[model samples]
Target chain A: MGVRIQMPLSLRERIGMEEMVEVEGDTVGRCLEDLTRKWPELKGELLDPNGRLLLRWTIYLNGRPPSSSEELEQYVSEGDIITLLPLVDGG
Target chain B: MEREIPGGYNGRILRVDLSRERIDQVDLDASLCRRLLGGAGFIAYFLLKELPQGTDPFGPENKLVFASGPLTGIPLGGCARHTVGAKSPLTGGIAKSEAGESWGPQLKRAGFDALIVEGRAHRPVYLWIHDGDAEIRDASSLWGKETRETQEKIREEVGEARASLAMIGPGGENLVRYACIMHGCFDAAGRGGLGAVMGSKNLKAVAVRGDRMPPLKDPQAVKRMAAWLKDHMDLVKAFSDYGTGSPMPRFEQVGNLPVRNFRDGGFPQVERITPQTIKGTIRVGMKGCFACPVQCKKEVEFREPYHVDRIYGGPEYETLAALGSACGIDDLKAISKGSERCNAYSIDTISTGMSIAFAMECFENGLLTLEDTGGLELRFGNAEAMLEMIERIARREGLGALLAEGTVRAAQRIGKGTEAYAMHVKGQELPMHEPRLSKALGLGYMVNPHGADHMDSMIDLFFSAFTAQPTVAVPDLIPLGMEPAPLDDIGPRKVALFKAFQAKRIVADSLVLCHFLPYSFSQVAEITSAVTGWETTPMEQIRVSERILTLCRLFNLREGITDEADRLPERFFYPTQDGPLAHRSLSPDEMERAKRYYYRLLGWDDRGVPTPERLEELGISELEG
Candidate 1:
């Protein structure tokens, strides 16, 4: 089993309109790297030049943010869900 | 007449005294425009100057000002907006709310910067305004009509098929305390019970028609701004594509969405009602206001479970959260139907949904009984009961009569320790944003003059370390010297940032600009200069915004809404039951300290009153006398 990466509708266009994609990785960073490798165009959309998650996006591991000090290095198990959602400003 | 008035102005204010059946034109003062700008600024000035202290909000003495700014009718995107202000029947304080559509621009084009409505009409009446003229016509036939029907009938009667209307529905006619003024069929000045004030006057609607555009000082500059917005549509693609409720799941993840009367933090079912789901299931089209290119306004239609018309528009983020997650109902169709009913009846979705949520919680806790809800199970996740409650609230029937007064008063009337469940600040029901996740916003909820307004201040998450980057910096706050602060910081630095952001927000309201648009302060200053030919700057606009806010504070204080009323609800001071912010809660002491610091930053004394010295600095010291 692999980790399923869920993307918000705002970013689905870059990934051929797929709401969620599955990839194999043990860490959040590796999963995102695999996601970018598959889509190619999502690298700039999801990450900055420093290879960090863009400020506009938040990552949730199974509906909650990872509790580790290093969010990108948080370990994941098989069949875990990684969701990326854009930051909403106002009501 | 054109030469005497400044550019972007008609140099006229329509004054309608319904009591006397008298109509008069008051010349717009150039000085007032220079000092207070317009919209919220004009409302603050007129309400304070004319309204007596302790006047009953629904009494004949209360006044309603519908105002547009210099930027209105200038062919710019996001400029088709207006502010409606009065003494709120809901909060009993300064009431100001803004709406976007064609009505504000039509009002400006009809040869007035603002319309001041006062006194109760002897009978139901609707004002028909055309190019540089006005008439009050009998609206007895239109008294109990819904918003869409009223619009159609008024347009037919006036023989102006294109005339824009601002009208009320049964919710207003019945004087539900949270009734909103519906503009067009979709847009609403949806806070502070301004519609109840309209209802009290026996006024049904105001129909405006005109082709006369206010001459711009630099037409090319205005055109360039419009073109710039058109060219940069990519900047707002998400809004254009999915509209406001597109980020529901994100809001849930961050613990910002109000769940189950703000008692819980997690609503895993939020994905069911997001804009994407709506688009996939029921959305028919996307529309825009006046010259706006973004077209963020959503139009939805469905006939399966409930017949929801597109004319009433679809639910935005606030509506979705208030009616969906807050009530613990994930039935998207029911939520959409509730939204449609609110638009039809002209009640505020936020307050209506929140009131229902409060009642549901109270009922669950045994404070209310089946007998109290008239045999209805007023419980959370009871979508049928929630839908029925919306209708009941609008018509002020049975339990709705208590809820019609809004949660603060309703809890008092219930009197079974239900006050703790009433999540509100002052008398206004809190919007969907959770203050625990964004501490500065919590402080904003406490100290905002009108009470619990999310639009008046910046959300802390936007400025938190998670999202603070040079590329994604908020254009408006950067010019005001704002920097990133921790999301939970309710200290001096956060208060300072809140003060600056509040000033910018007030400027947007004064200009009647749409908050969704990404306009920098300098860009706004440039637009103002282009329209009015004034040598304006960002700092000058900030100062003017401060003046308007101070004036609103004075009006509220004069009406006995003191600094003591500046506080959050009890729910926010405690942690949510679960979610990302399950362990988080706002410290009451820190909030109090932050509020004091904010007062000092705004040059207000410890009592939250603008000091005489500060009033002098703002150039409104004469009002203090």
Candidate 2:
């Protein structure tokens, strides 16, 4: 399945300047794993020491956040679009 | 009290009774100092006890507290910050806004940890402080003057070119509900109508110049700490390079930036107002607060239709979002001019922009006619109209008077479903951040005593990092019995994290530290202990923060800001029209549950009111309204 993954400019600059990429995965986790495999530089930035999805990199699947029950283990469908947003700190 | 107790504090508070034209110095007890710390802590305690319940916010009964913290004036980065607090005329609740500039440190060096002004003066006046001494001078000549001219006049008259002044302008004098107090020319206690409280007291300005250096517990240790922090200068270089503007492009990318009065999730013209564009266009240089190495203040010199004064400083992220994208105006020059006018007139740029955006929406809906807008276009993306509205609001001309009333009250006056379009919480206009993108911030906005303040709690973005990255926040979270929760979850775990960070933010504000400063909880505790010799710990400081927060909540409850009033506008619960959050709106039931969970953690009842046991635990006295 082709899942469209969108990256923020901050991450896009570090990941070969591609605005969006298509990766194969049936679940959100696998999709992210595929993304990191494609752009190895994103591995450290998008995951914790435990190798779990980084919380700060907000992921919107199809223009909406995953429901609480799903979290990162949420299932994905073909043509699903996921946006990776960097952490924005406030004053 | 011992003659000169500790390193961090001056051990005295200057109390000014403007009505009697009397000045008195009161000793700050060590116990109180240890308990409340300073800044927002002191203000909350004082306001809760002294301000009578239901007292008119603009009356003499409402007191204004200008306080500095233990860390202030200690040659530490971000110590230049301080707080101005009062019973807000807009929110009708406790209002504490922190500002960064030279004024707080100067006031600290002038031998006072806090300055409390009460009672209204019979005539216009200004307070002058020089090296622990104080005097009241007639400000009749300085009345109605802009902040820049007032600061200039005060400096010249006081014969101290280095004097730091906090003054108000026509907006304040006219009692604009969201008026701010300008520090020197640019920095401001810009939320909650504090300037109006100053105007109500008939006080025009506060000028201070002090030569006495603050006594530190271990001068060598303080210097060593400063050096250590400065060694990591690269951490803040981006801030130094672009000020708060460094975060704009990132915020835009995240859909956190409020666009087109929050109807849209993204602004296509964001590239025009990014830090790079600002630096390339008119940025002359950068400025810094006292003893700060970051120098995150950008200076812009303008020409032609938007001849912004360099002294008034350049637009930061909030200004850029509020005046630039929020209004759907892509013209950076117009935003710059609007920002300059806001500074010059001593009004809040956030409130002003939000008010204009609300009016523009009304115009779009045909609720407002050309007759109402005085023939101005009053349309979204109309840069000229935006600039014109800023000036008009400052002068209270035509539609300006209604706009100056703020979005909440303005909507009431311009009824016909306009309230539905007014984007505000408890009458104070929302800042640049979008709630749908950051759930925790939205919750903070609803429950914050000051109403819709981003600084009241740690934003969700940081929490997201804490969950995923687990680096900086892990150590801080250890003491609070928390680990990061999932970003989309608003369950008990996330609520706990929110409460912990809220406590930390309270400590930051009370310490008078800048939000931009990267001070870990442990580091803050270490610095406080090193300066005050009080053996402060992170856990103990957090307890104090909890107490401070409870006191503020008590004040709010007493002032009639009930649970019903603690809510986001209808618009926030509606999905955005575009971008990542195109079909996303904060779920009201989930938000309510989050609020309830947070309250429960604080030992408050279901109504969000502090219980008797909670008050006893926090050492807060309940004031019966």
Model 2 lDDT, residue A27, Cα: 87
- lDDT winner among the candidates? 1
Candidate 1 lDDT, B260-292, residue by residue in tens: 999998988887888878887899999989988
Say which docking band candidate 1 falls in.
incorrect
Candidate 2: clashing pairs of residues = A54-B468, A55-B468, A56-B464
Q: Per-residue alpha-carbon lDDT of model 2 for B405-450, expressed as tens digits?
A: 8998988899999999888888889988888877777888888889
lDDT of 1 at B243: 81
- Weakest lDDT window of 10 consecutive positions for candidate 2 chain B: B466-475
For residue B163, what is the lDDT in candidate 1?
96
Cα displacement (Å) at residue B326, model 2: 0.6
Deviation (Å) of A20 in candidate 2: 27
Model 2: lDDT of residue B345: 93
CAPRI verdict on model 2? Answer: incorrect
